[model samples]
Target: MIDKLSWMAIYPEAALLIMACVIALLDLSTTSPRRTATYVLTLLTLAVIAVLTGFNAAAGKTIYGFGGMVVSDPMGNWLKCFATLALMVTLVYGRPYAADRGMLRGGEMFTMSMLALLGMFVMMSGSNFLVLYLGLELLTLSSYALVALRRDNALASEAAMKYFVLGAMASGFLLYGLSMMYGATGSLDINEVFKAIASRQVNHQVLVFGLVFIVAGLAFKVGAAPFHMWVPDVYQGAPTAITLLIGAAPELAAFAIIIRLLVEGLLPLAIDWQQMLTLLAIASLLVGNLAAIAQTNLKRMLAYSTIAQMGFMLLGLVAGVVNGNTYNAQFAYSAAMFYIVTYVLTTLASFGIILLLAREGFESEEITDLAGLNQRSPLYAGVMAIAMFSLAGVPPLVGFYAKFAVLQALIASGQAMHIALAVFAVVMSLIGAFYYLRVVKVMYFDAPLTATTVAAPPDVRAVLTVNGALILILGILPGSLMTLCAQAIVATLAS
Candidate 1:
């Protein structure tokens, strides 16, 4: 009966895929300009799906589809919500820019966007290596095309090529790692791999090597340092809309990959990956923060900042594994999830502002581009200031609390290095503050780049209203979201 209750739970994910295909078909068949209609319909579809997912969660049923490959746990539910919200914000932000640039291409853009969302769905629900890989590929492929949508822009073309080449190499490493793991355990199922590893006590060095490769592959996807050479370039070169999409989902998906494999499949080999993550985290912090300071381009700066954030998330994973307490691990995981949510909102909001200033054939990449913005639109300047403060982990902002919670988890577990890294993270964040504030300084102090304020499309305005309010709202009352995060981690990693 549980299996047969219509299984409408997965409709949220299916809606995205179905919408993508349908939009593509309609575009090819009819040359009518129903672009706004497509946008409205797409947003509506996602809204309905979000409502359904919420309803399913409230009903308290564990819904799985495709023979246990896609589990409907709280982790899936939460990430799905994050992915959808982020995409919605991007659509609202991008619609005007796309229209102005004459690049919306109506159906094509909508299709790729939804396809990327579907890829995110795969990441959220994937319970096996095969499903995870498939999902990741779908997201990567869609991202590549979206980046190159302009076709004529040299930078966009270059970004797509680099992304494709690097993405292929990462896939190769991941596939090789999966093959090695299969060789060691004679199984591809995560549950079976865990049981086998737990039951046997042998030095399976081959499997360990596979773990290294697998983690390397995942780090590449997350754009973590030492595996992050491609990040700034891609983020800088991709269309701003595509950059927004890439930033939102891939890191969350990478985190899921780590949770499923490192936390479950290789638990007995804890010391190994924990040490690896610590070193990786430190490298990411140093490289990401140090490199970001020199970037003149806003998108590239944010891309490096993303790398820095990934490093912080790994701090939580290392804390969880090394401390050897289930509750501590849960706290660490919950902290990481909270941070991800915080970062996603902040990142989307930041990008949305960038879109506001951006127009066709006039992409605003330089920090100088925003000179004298505060006087032009005090509201935008204020909202952007809060976003910057929050991103820098300043006090009374949600970003600060996210970092604080993780730091507390690390110190409470008595991990000396974790505490040290948090200190370093704070320092790098201080270094990062210089740039985030530069945007603020330009807005507040410098003369206006444009004497007249630009007006945005209504959709963009509506989206900003929610996005701006959310950052402060979260900072003020994070308890509810924090509780939900804690519960989600519990549902995902059953002890």
Candidate 2:
């Protein structure tokens, strides 16, 4: 039987699971096309979960439960809080789009997204290999269903099929690697594995081999280069609302799992994984930046941009634990955390504008589709401009500071190789800026294709405005969030 502490550690997750089921059942009784009642309930549930997690994070206590199969820590709780809020914003922005495209027929989208978020929470809290894999499967399965929500759309169906095939392959790789790790260390609990590896008795070759597969699997999850083949196709083919659902909050879960697997569980082998991460980062920057430039489709462009942004985040991971000292580990990992959080904020606004501009029977997908958006609606155009500028790493935007923090961490390592990687990242960012700015130019300079003006529901407008403003506000005052990340990392490390 589970103890009280185990239940406490998972209260928010329990609430989410129960509420999701309730919403699903309640939705069946409603006949409204938009499922307005179900939608409001879902948002309310998410808001409460976000607040609950935020309080738990602020408590700054690390608790392990269920025979140490799971953990609740400041870092995990904070990420969960942010992810919950991000999902709330996503649903708000996505509802109109989903309604227009008839993707909300039975409230599956709402239920599935909540289930997906529950999966993320589990992934973040999991302390055992089996537990993490279980969470990963739950999240991926829900995502596949949500992607295929538009069953009448052939493209959505195709995207779902591709995602399932590729996702299953990646999951297999991760599971096999975890099995190898367990074989080598004789434990599935992360702390036990860490102790076993730190003892240094495991066969080096087998461990390294498992690490290779594990890194490859993680690279795919984060959409890094060489493993990013599915990103562009899925982003372009899925209904835009579904695209945002897949793109936004899932990233935090990915980051949390990486920390759990690599930094927390396998740090004794940092030299090996750090080298692998470096190669992945370099390739991601090169491929993501160059390929994004050639994409005229806006969603595909952002997909590549996500690849490049993740590459930059990986640099921070690469800088951690240099020479096995681990003196710089907290700072480096916190920098990555900050970058990802800010990147998600910027992404929500960018896609919000895209969803807003997409009317019934029209997809604002191509770069040319945004032509003279400023003439049609300056509010949206300005929001889009801020997102683009931030993504381009323009000064006084959060993206710039995110990049700077990562580069600073790299430089602080005082290694010639780390400095050189920082330089390469900088150059890639320069190339990335061109594509990002091209979007801005199209919005401000080109002629409007249609005379219709953009209009948004008040909720979307308010959230989008706040989202865009956060990108700028965080840029101007990044210290608080950066400090919060640092504290969370430090607390996690201490526990």
Candidate 3:
């Protein structure tokens, strides 16, 4: 029998699973263009779960449950809370677009998203390899189905097949890596693996071999270059709503798993992995930025940009520990965490605008499709502009500060290579800016492609406004969030 303490640690997850089931059942009996009742219920459930996760974070005490399979700490709880908010915002922004594409004919979009959130929650809280893998599969499986939801679209079907094949291969890599570690350490528990490695009881060669596969698997999940072949195709092929769904929220989960596996479970092997991460960061930055400049499609451009942004995040990870010293670990990891959170925020708005511009028969997917958007709707134009500028890492926006923090963390390491890496990342950011600014120019300067006069629902308008404002607000006042991130990392590391 599970004890009360263990039950409390997973209450939010339990609630989400039950509510997802309830919403799926309820949707079967309703028939509306937006799936109004199901939409409302899903949003409400996410909000309630976000509150619960916030409260859990506030409690500030780490709780291990299910015989140490899951551990709820401030870091995980905070990630979970923000992930729920991201998902909720995704649904709100996606509903109209999904409806326009005939995807709202059923409630699978909302239900699968909720299930994906549950998977993220599990990933955030999981302290064992099996639990983490289970969570990942749950999320990926739902994502595959969501991508194919529009069965009539040949591109959607193709995207689903590509995602499924690539995702399965990545899973195999991760599982094989885990099996190697288990064989070497004689344990499946992450903490025990950490202990075994730290005590120098494990085979270093085997561990290094496994680390390569694990990093490859993780790099695939995050769309890091060399493993990023599927990203542009999938992003352009899937429905925009599904694209946004895939793009925004899973990143938070990806960040969580990186922390859990690399920091918590494999810190003793920092030297080996950090070098790998550095290579990944450089390759991602070079490939992603350069490839993005050649893309005519907005979704594909953003996909390459995702790879580059994740590269910046990896820079933070690489700077965490040096020479077997973890003194700078908190700042480094926290900077990565902040970058990913703010990146997701900007991505939500970026894709939200794309979805808004889409209609029953037109998908505003091409960069030219955004021409003269300013003339049609300044509010949306401004939102997209803010998103574009933020993504480009321009000053007085959250993305700038996120890059600043990571660069600071890199330079603070006082290593010549890290400093050089920081400079390279900056140059890549400059190159990336050209493409982002082009989108803004098209929106403001180019002639209108049509005179449809883009009109968005009030709720979408409100969310976009808030989303744009938050980018500026967080940039101007990043201290509080930075402090929160630092504290979360410190608390969890200490525990």
Q: Which of 1 and 2 is the better model by lDDT?
A: 2
In angstroms, how far off is 158's CA in candidate 1?
0.3
| Candidate 2 residue lDDT tens string, 453-480 | 8989999999999998899999999999
Prediction 2 TM-score vs. true: 0.99
List the candidates' TM-scores in order: 0.95, 0.99, 0.99
State how far residue 215 of model 2 sits from its true place (Å). 0.8
Pairs of colliding residues, candidate 1: none
On the 0 to 100 scale, the lDDT of residue 184 in model 2 is: 97
lDDT minimum window of 10 residues, candidate 2: 100-109
Model 3: colliding residue pairs: none
Best by lDDT: 2
lDDT of each: 0.80, 0.94, 0.94
Which residues of candidate 2, in runs, are more than 4 Å off?
none
State the lDDT of candidate 3 residue by residue for 324-351, as single tens digits. 8998899999999999999999999999
lDDT score at residue 328, model 2, on the 0-100 scale: 94
